[model samples]
Target chain A: MSVDQFLQYLISGITQGSIYALVALGFTIIYAVTRVINFAQGEFVMLGGMLSFLLISSFGIPLIPSLILAVLFTAIIGAIIYLLAIRTAKKASVVSLIIITIGVSIFIRGFTREFLGVDSVRPPFFTGDESLTIFGALIRPQALWIIGTTIVVTIILHLFLSRTMMGNALKASAISTRAAAMVGIDSRVMALTAFVIAAVIGSIGGAVMAPLVLTSYNVGVMLGLKGFVSASIGGFKSPIISVIGGITIGVIESLAVGINWGPFTSSYKDAIAIVALLIILLIRSGRLALEERAD
Target chain B: MFGFVKNKWIYFLVGALLAVMVLIPFDWFMGKYNTLLIFIGLNTMVTVGLCLLMGYTGQVSLGQAAYYGIGAYISAILSKTYGVNPWLAMLIAAIVTGAFAYGIGYLIFRLKGNYLAMATLGLGLIIWILFRQLSEITGGPDGMGGIPYLSIGGFGFYTTFKRYYLVWFFCLALLLISQNIVRSRTGRALRAIHGSEDAAESIGINVAQFKVKIFALSAVFASIAGSLFVHHLRFVSPQPFGFLASVKLVVMAVIGGLASIWGAIFGAATTNILSDELLLGFGELDTIVYGLILMLVMIFMPQGLFVKLKEIIVQWRSKTTQKV
Candidate 1:
C-alpha cells in the first residue's frame, strides 16, 4: 500500500478501534468482577447513540446535554438489568447465566427496533464535518474526538483502579470476594458498580462514534461479538491487552477492505473478527494445556 | 406377553405413536397439520441430539445452526448442481459435519462453560457468513434452490404428505435409538460425566473423548434436520440456519426438559407451533416474546417446562388415586 493509502486505512482503523476498545473495556469490567460476560454491552452503546438521537432531534434537547443524559440513561438501564435479571438468578449455572444475558440483549434490540424504527441514525458531529488534508490523506475531526476520548478514558480508568479507594476495593473484590467481604467490601455492590461503569463507558463510545458509523438497533449484535473477541484476546484479564486486541481487530477489518482478492471483499470483513476469535480461543486452550502440564 | 409390561408409559407412548402413524395417511390428519408435523419432526431430530449432549453430557452449544446449515447446503449443492442422489448427499453431509464437529471439539472442549459457548457461537457465525459471502456456490443471501428430493425406488418423496411421513419415520427412529442409548452403557457414562466430570474422570471415564463424541453426534443430528428441512422447502438459505436457529434448538431442548428424551418432542411441537402460528402475525415482535420465554423458563423452572408439567400431572394423578 502507498503512504497515503496506508494513512487513510490507519485513520479509519483507529477510529473503529476506539469504539471496539470502549466495548471491550465494558466486557472486561463485567467479566473481571462477576465472571459474567454482559452480552448487552454493545446494546448500551446502541442505546447511547439512539437515545442521544431521540433526545437531540425529537426531544428538543441540545447536543451536549443529550449526550450526557443518554450515557446516564443507558447506565441506569444497566443497573436495572443487574438488579432484575442477574440478582434474582444468582444460583443459576454458567449456561443459564449466558442465556440470560443473551435474552437481555435480544430484548433490548427488540424494543429498540419497535420504538426507534430500524433506520440508521447519527447524531450531529461534535465538530462540523470538515475534512482535514494531511499528507494527501483526509481525516475527520470526529476521528480525533474518538481517539482522544479513548486515551482519556483509558488513563482515567487506570488512575481510578490504582489510586482511588473505591476502585481498589472493586479490584480487591474481583481478586477475592471472600477476602474482600471480610474486609467489609460488599461484593454485590461491587458487581452492580461494574455494570454501571461498563455501561457508561459503552454508551459514551456509542454516542461519540454515532456521527461516524450510523447507529441502528441490530448493530449491537455484531459489535458485541467483535468486542467479545477483543476481550478474549486479553484473556479477559488486562485492560491494556484488551485495548490492543480491539485496535488489532479494527485495523484488520479496515485492511480487509483496502486489499481485495476478487472473491473476498468488505462483505466477508466481519468474518475476519470471527476468525480472530477462533484463533485466540484455540491459542488460549493450547496455553491452558501447557500450563496444566507444567503444573 | 400379556404379563410382561416392563413400562406402562412406554407401551402407551408406542401405541399413541402407532395410532398417529396410521392416521397420518388419512386426509383428516395430513390435510390440516402436514407442514406443522413436518417441522416438529425436523426439530425433534435436532433437539433429541441436543438432549443427549446438554441433558446427558451437561455441555452447552449455541452454534448447532452451523452444523444444520452445513447439512442443508451440502445436500442442496450436491443434489442440485452435481446430480448426486439427495439421500447420498444427506449421508455425506452428516459425515462431513460430524468430522468437522470432532475437529473443532478438540480445540473448544478444552474450554469449559462460557468460553466454550463463545467458541461455538463464533463457529456458527463464521458458517453463516460463509453462506452469505460464498455467492458463487451458495447464491449469496438469496440462497440456492431447485434441490432434488429423497426417494425410494422410483417414488420420490416430493409431496408434503410423503415427506411428512419420511421425516417422522427418521425422527421417531432417532428418538427410539437415543432413548435406548440412555438405558445402555454409553448413556450411563454420559450421565456420569454430567453428574461430575472430574468424578467421572477419576473413575476412569474418558471425559474428553466422551464429550467430543457427543458433540459430534449432536452435530450429525442437526445436519440431518437441516437436510430434511431444505428438501422439504425445496430451497436452502442462510437465514433460517444461523445463531437464532441454534438458540431455538436449545430452547426446545430446555423447554422439553433436557434430561428426558421424550421432552424433545413436546418442546419442538410447542415451540414450532408458537413460531408458526403466533409469530406469523407479529413478525419482528416474535423475538421479544421468544427472549422473554427463554429467560422466564431458565429462571423460574430450570428443569424445563415439560418436566414441571409432568410433575403436576403426577401430583394430580396421585390425588385422584387417594380419592379411590
Candidate 2:
C-alpha cells in the first residue's frame, strides 16, 4: 500500500479503534472489580447512541443536552443492571453469571427494538460533516471527535485511578476484597462504581461515534463481541493494555480490508480480527488458566 | 404375577409413559402439533448433550449451534448435492462433528469458565460467518434446500407424523444413554471434576480427557439433532445456527436443570411450546419473556425448574404424610 493509503487506513483504524478502546475499558473495569464479563456492556453504548438520537431527532431536543442526558440515563441503567440482576444473583456460578449477563443483553436489545424500532439511526455530527486533510490523508471531523474523546477519557481515567482516594479503594478491592473490607472499603459499593464508570465511558463512545457509525438496537451484539475481543487481547487485566489491543485490532482489520488481496476483502474484516483473537487466546491459554486458578 | 407387577410399579409407569409418547402423534387432537413435538424432540436431543456437558461436567459451551450447523450442512450437502443415502450422510455428519469437537475441546478446555464461554462464542460466530460466506459450498446466507428425508428401505419419513416418531426415537434413545452415563462410574468422576478439578486430578481422574470426550459426545448429539432437523425440513439455513440459537440451547439446558437427564425433555418442551404456541401472538414479547425466564431461573432457582419442583413436591408430600 502507498504511504497516503496506509495513512488513510491508519487514521480510520485509529478512529474506529477509539470506540473499541472505550468499550474495552468498560470491560476491563467491570472484570477487574466484579470478575463478571458483563456481556451487556455493549448495550450501554447502544443506549447512549440511540437515546441521544431519539432525543435530538424525535423529541426535538438540542444535541449537547441530549448527549448529556443519554450518558446519564445509560449510567443509571448500568447501575440498575448491577443492583437488580448481578447483585441479586448472589453466589452464582461462572456459567450462571455468563447466562445472566447474556439475558440482560437480550432484554436490552429486545426492549430497544420494541420501543425504538429497528431502523439504524445516526445523530448529527458534533461540529460538521467535513473532511480535513491531515498529512495527505483525509479524516472526518467526527472521527477526530471519537479519537479525541478516547484520548481524553484515557488520560482522565489514568489520573482518577492514580491520584484519587476513591479510585485507590476501588483498586484495593479489586486486589483483594477481604483486605479492602478490613480497611473499611465496601466491595459491593466499589463494584457498583465500576459499573457506573463503565457505563459512562461506553455511552461517551456511542454518542461520539454515532455520526460516524449508525446506531441500532442490535448493534450491541457485534460491538460487545468486538470489545470483549479487544479486552481479551490485553488478557482483560489492564485498561491501558486493552486500549492498545483495541487499536491494534482496528488497525489490523482496516489494513486487512484495505489490502484487498485474496480473502482479505471487506466482507471478511470481522473474521480477521476474531481469528487474530483466537490465536492470541490459544497462545495465552496456559497463563490465563494459571491466573484464573490463582483467583 | 400380580405381586411382581405391584413390586415393579416404576417399570409399569415407564411402560405407560412410553406408550403415551408413541401414541401422541396418532391422536387427532395432539397430532395437529406434531411439528412442534418434533422440534421439541430435536431440541431435547441437543439439550440432553448440553446437560451432560454443563450440568454434570461443569463446562459451559455457548457455541453448540456450530456443531448443529456442521451436521446440518454436511448431511444436507451429502444427501442433496452428492446423492448419498440420507442415513449414511447423517452418520458421516455426526462422526465428522464429533471429531471436529474433539479437536476444539482439546485446545479449548484448557481455559476455565468465562474464557471458555468466549472462545466457544467466537467459534460459533466464525462458523456462522462461514455458513454465510461459503457460497460455493454452503449456498451462503440464502442457504441450501431440497435435502432428502431419512428412510428405512423404501419407507420414508415423509410426513410430520412420521418424522415426529423418528425424532423422538433418536431423542429418547440418546436421553436413555445419557441417563445411563450419568448413573455410571464415569458420572462420578465427572461430578468429582465438577466439584474441584484439582481434587479430581489428585484422585487420579483424567480430567482433561474426560472433558474432551464429553464435549465430543455432546457435539455428536447436537449433530444428530441437526441431521434430524434438516431431513425433517428438507432445508438447511445458516440462521438457526447463529449465536442466538446457541443461547436458546443453553436456555433449554438451564431450564431442564443442567444435570438432570429427564429434565431435558421438560425444558425443551416448555421452551418450544412457549415460543411456538403460547407466546407467538405476542411477537417481540417472547424475547423479553425468555430473557426474564433465564434471569429469574438462574437467580431464584439455579437448580432448575424440574429439580426445584421435585423438591417442593417432596416437601409437600412429607408434610401431608406427617399430618396424616
List interface RMSDs for the candidates, in order.
1.7, 1.1
- The number of clashing residue pairs in model 2 is 0
lDDT, residue B34, model 1: 86
**Model 2 superposed RMSD (Cα):** 1.9
lDDT of 2 by residue, B1-324 (tens): 866965698688889998888889975658988999999999999999999999988899989988988999999999999999999999999999999999999988888888888888888888888899888988999998888988999898899989988999999899989989989999999999999999999999999999999999999999999999999999988999998889888888888898899999999999999889998876566677778878999999987988899899879977997999
Docking class of 1: medium
lDDT string, candidate 2, A70-150, tens digits:
999999999999999999996899989998999898888889888999899989989998899989999999999999999
- True-structure RMSD, every candidate: 2.5, 1.9
Instruction: Tell me candidate 1's fraction of native contacts, as a decimal between 0 and 1.
Output: 0.51
Task: Score residue B182 of candidate 2 by CA lDDT.
Answer: 89
Best by lDDT: 2
DockQ of candidate 2 (2 decimals): 0.74
Best by DockQ: 2
Report the C-alpha lDDT of model 1 over A1-295, residue by residue, as the tens digit: 8899988988898889889988999999998888888878889999999999999989989999999999999999999989988888888887788878888888888888888888999888888999999888899999989989998998999899999999999899888788899999999999999999999999999999999888998888788889988898887778888888898889888887788775347887888888888888777886745533432
Alpha-carbon lDDT, every model:
0.87, 0.91
After superposing candidate 2 on the true structure, give the runs of residues whose Cα lies further than 4 Å from its correct spot: B1-9
Clash counts for all predictions: 0, 0
Tell me the native contact fraction for each prediction: 0.51, 0.60
